[model samples]
Target: MHIYSSHVLVCSGTSCTSKKSPELIKKLEEGIKRKKLDEKIQVITTSCFGLCAEGPIVVVYPEGAIYSNVTLNDIDEIINEHLVKGRIVKRLLSGNNEGNNSYESADFFKKQVRIALRNCGVINPEIIEEYIAYDGYQALGKVLTTMTPEQVIDKVLDSGLRGRGGAGFPTGRKWLFAANAKGDKKYVCCNADEGDPGAFMDRSILEGDPHSIIEAMAIAAYGIGSDQGYIYVRAEYPIAVKRLNIAIDQAKELGLLGDKIFGTDFSFNLELRLGAGAFVCGEETALMTSIEGKRGEPRPRPPFPANKGLFQKPTILNNVETLSNIPIIILKGADWFKTIGTKKSPGTKVFAIGGKINNTGLVEIPMGTTLREVIYDIGGGIPNGKKFKAAQTGGPSGGCIPTEHLDVPIEYDTLIELGSMMGSGGLIIMDEDNCMVDIAKFFLEFSVDESCGKCPPCRIGTKRMYGILKRITEGKGEEGDIETLEELAETIQAAALCGLGKTSPNPVLSTLRYFRHEYEEHIVNKKCSAGVCKELLDYIIIPNDCMGCTKCIKVCPTKAITGKIKEPHIIDQEECIKCGACLEACPFGAIIRK
Candidate 1:
């Protein structure tokens, strides 16, 4: 292997790809070839660079010169100035205009501790050699050649790593249960079925470092004495699925995944299972059932997957984010891994921060990082000068953390204590414009639609809760509706069979816990404080502020606005529809929602 003079890493993550990073890559390659520098310059397509806001991003190493929002037209200048002449592109570089000079100076990358996402923007995911060059499969080699199955389990136990898949269960304990199960045939499963609304941590890891998950699965197979493994990924993630297939084929070709792996007696093989976009299938039992070619539905516990799973054999399932960290834990040693994070939660967590935030992208920080840091510092604070209202973490199954709990350390126990579980690490920030009652209703509606309906508590309880929330948002809520919603939430939580049904009430429960005042305003005052619930809001024209602009009339879909030039507008109350088009179109800010 020869070292190249320079490496140009272009982010091919979904966010950057949407911004035409692929075309930028092509232009870079063509320009390098046109300059007769292909031999010296290596252009690579890597995973997300974390700063998705500034993409299509290109980082040239080993100088670490960061270019934000690069285009195909800029490729020539970059090649002529930076790549060939070895000068930095000051205009394209990220960070403030004054102080900092390099990529590290950017506030986004400075605060982030990329553990699960370390290799995301650094290496070419499609190339197996690059993965190996970065100490990728070295953990599997170490585990296969030296460490016994018991030793592997003990190391994970000592590391204090819990599942990143939201349950926060000790990973080593789950592995031990499967290893101890009395069965002739056992299996290792990777749950890549990430269905959380705002979450892309799993998909990014899979797309950027599929080899990590593959290698981790192999090590898990060795630890649990399983000869077969399956990765149940959602079909929505076509790029991740495609790359995972490539990584698996490459692994098999290199004699890393087939019979007599690395000259050891252990034989492990992996297969792909595509999910039909069922959110309920994210649950372990439902995922196993889907893998077994059956309708995805959660079954009763006690006969957990460790005892009876996937063709009635003992099975261990870990999500993609959870598996991605396995290789590092093994290679770095348990004690070394344990020293980085909180005492109990010993690893980094990847969060998909979206909604009302300035910097919306995938962020991986240490486990004990505060919500304030994630929301204010890392997320660049809320957008549009809007006050921070609340943050919905952990997806539909997770709960909301209000502004009061912003100081909470984002650990598994701390979030759970505040009525939110770390479900796949999706932290959606809400601003003052967002209505808490409507937000809860929106998540409950999602839960109701995704429920498998196999269990009565989840099916009926979710429907009842959603109905109560709907009535509240639609201005039909009664005084006792809040009490009724709480009751239904409790029932669904206690009686539901699987994780999906049990945690379905999280959105409602958490909102009620923190933003009960919002619910009270909806039910008692018949008003939406955020002015989001259209049914409870009335659009009025302020004559003093109105410049008699007819712009609102032209844009109204319902033709509800009646006004002439140099005259105040009048909205037909019955035909208004509460669309707020007038409110948006008014130049003088005359239209107001009350």
Candidate 2:
């Protein structure tokens, strides 16, 4: 075995890979081998470091120095200066305030508690040996060798680990139900169809720590008395799909998966199923249906997955983030796990931070952490010195949180109390310039498009509500449009068949609950306060700033602006199409949208 004094950990997660981290890896390896330091130095590809805004992340072990936005240009410097010369490359270091180069010390990762994300940025996901080195399969080994099915379920139950995949259902109870269900044939499944907009929490886990999911699924199968398992991942995640395939093959070779695991009577085999990128398949029943070679659509609950899941068999299904916690809970003990977060919502949550924030990436913070901390402290506040207007959680099926609730603790129930659910952990921060009504319309549009059309309430009712919102944004709203939207939202919530249908009105409802005034303004006054609704905006030239430059007149497609040289310009409101061509052409800060 080749022993190396220093290890180079490069991020190869999807975000960084898109940013050419793979090229960086090849460059570093070739450079290191050229220097004849291959015997003493090792270069390893790991998963996401969560700070995706500054991706292509590279961390050198022994020194724990992290460099961000690493490029092919920066690779030789890293290899020559940091790897060979043993000197820190200060130029490319990220979050290096006051000379601190550690990832943990960076504002983005400082307060994060990474239980689910523990092995993410730390190990080579493709290598089972690296996973095993970090006590990876110890939990499964413990479960199969020392523990029984009932005890395993009990441990999870006592841990208070709720599902991180939106619904916040108790994972242990789901396992217990599956165990108690009367079925000769049973199964364990994983939900990796993460279709939430701006959400990649599950994808990161799959890309970074594929073995953990395999081990956790094996433990789940043991607890639930199942021999067959399937992991339903989206085909859109090509990298994640490839890594999961590699990890599963490695696990089977080591006897961690397949028949007689750990030389016990317990036997289980696993298979991977790819989805056609249906958003509704993120729901368990729909995912199961897709795996069963049917169109992905949700089945009404009552005979839930625990009772009758994939192929008419009793099954237990958990999302990637939820299952990722099982191995840690088994090894650390339930009592130890319960001590981290709030009582009702124990452990940490992994959120994919997007929209208007300084740090747009992935974050794993304790459940009880406040919205204030997540937005300001961890996300580095809203970008461009803009005040935070709202945050949309749970994707198209989620609601928005206004400024008033900034300090509220981000628990599963607390967010629901504020008219939002923790849907798949997509936290999108909106700045003051965002139009609330338009934001609601955006999510509603997504829900409308993604709806399976299996239920009339979701398909037809969401369309009606969207029509009203569209009219309001276009300055054609009627007086009762707000009331009509509220009525339709209530009807859809009450009547929609599956969860995708049921929660489709969440964005409109939550926005209405908090920002009702914005709706009224749009309807009654024909004004969009944020000036985002183009139809409701008028571009006026500020006389003081305008130099009568023909720039505005020259660029206007409709010849809407007219003025002499060195004099103030004027735009014909009737002729302007609100394209803002004149706004872009004006060199002076003259054009104002109202």
Candidate 3:
């Protein structure tokens, strides 16, 4: 075995890779060789460090000194000053201040408690040996060697792990149902079709820690008494799919995946199933249908997947994030896992925080962490000093959380109580500039488009709701439109065939529940309060503020702003396209949308 005096861990996660961390890696290697420290020092590329705002991160082990925002130029300095001389590089170190103590006191990592993300930035995901070094397959070994299927299910049941994939169903109970179902040919399915917008928590896990999911699936297969497993990953995530394939190949080569037993009687095999980018397939039945080479549509449930699943046999399905937690729960013991979060919702949740936030990336926090903590402390509050208006959780099937609920604990029940859900953990922050009605319409449009046309409630009902939202946003809303929306939302919620239809009204319903005043303004006053819906807005020139720079006139596509240089500009309302190019192009505070 090759032994090194020190190890250089560089982040090769998607965010860092986009920032050229791979090139940075090459530079470090050349620098190490040039300094004649190649034998003594080792460089390893790993996964996300979570502090993505400071990307291209490097951490030196045996000293645990973390460096942020590293470039090719800084590589030589790190190699010469730190690797050879055994000194810390001051400039590259993280934290608010600049010293050894400062790096340790960094605010970025101080409050975080890594459980699901523990192995993310620590090991090479493609290499099984490195995974083994980090005790990757230890859980599988323990389960296969000692525990029975019933015993394994019991352990998970005691762990208090609910499914992280939107619905928050108890994972152990799901497994138990499949285990009890008497079927000669049972299977395990992994829901990797992460269709939610801005939700890449599952994708990151697949990219950075593919082996974890693979191992967890093996554990689940054993628990569910299944010999075959299929991972239904979306085709959109090429990187994640590539890494997942690599991990599966590596695991199979190591005798961990294919008809292999780790030398036990248990034998399980896994395969990849690609999705054709249908958002509706995020639902289990729809995902199964897609995997079976059929149109992605949800079937009626009662004989749920546990009773009659893949190939019409008993099957257990768990999402990527839920599977990611399985090995850890089994390895550490259920009691150990249960101690982390709230009693009902134990364990950590990975949230993809994006849209109008300062720190836009994946975050793993305990289930009970407050929205204020996630938005203010971790997300760095709303960007550019804008007041936080609301947050949209659960993508199209979820609701908007108003500012009043910022302090609410972010568990499954809490969010549902507030008219949102823990739907796949896509927490999108919205600032004061966002219009509530427009936001609802935007999500409804997505829901309408993604509806599989299988159920009338989801297909036609969402379309009708979206049309109403469109009319309201366009200043053509009637006084009865609000009541109509409410009636339609309730009808859809009660009558929809699957979860996709049932939860499709969430955005409209929640926005109406919380921000009805905005709707009233758009309908009764014929004005969009946030000035987002273009049809209800008219861009006018504020003559007092206009500098007459003619920049807006030159940039306007419709020649709306007509004025000579050095004089106040005037907007020709008849020619105005309402594209807001003038508003965006105006350097001065000249253009006002009213």
Order the candidates by TM-score, highest first — what do you get? 2, 1, 3
| C-alpha RMSD between model 3 and the true structure | 11.9
lDDT of 3 by residue, 1-594 (tens): 989999999999999999999998899998889888899889999999898999989999899999999988898888888888889998888778556665325554555667777788778888888988988999999999999989999999999899999999999999999999999999999999998888998888888889998899899989988999999999999998998889888888888987757888788888999998989898999888888899888999978999899889999899999998988888899998988889999999999999999988778888888999988888888878999999999999899998899898889999999999999989999988899999999999999999999888888999999999999888899999999999999999999999989999999889989999999999999888786888888899999998889999899998777788889989888888899888889898788888
True-vs-predicted CA distance for residue 188, candidate 1, Å: 0.0
lDDT of 2: 0.92
Model 3 residue pairs with clashes: none
lDDT tens per residue, model 2, 208-253: 9999999999999999889988999999999999999999899989
**Candidate 1 residue runs with Cα over 4 Å from true position:** 1-104, 549-567
TM-score, candidate number 1 = 0.83
Shift in Å, residue 438, candidate 3: 0.8
Clashing pairs in 1: none
Per lDDT, the best of the predicted structures is 2
Higher lDDT: candidate 1 or 3?
1
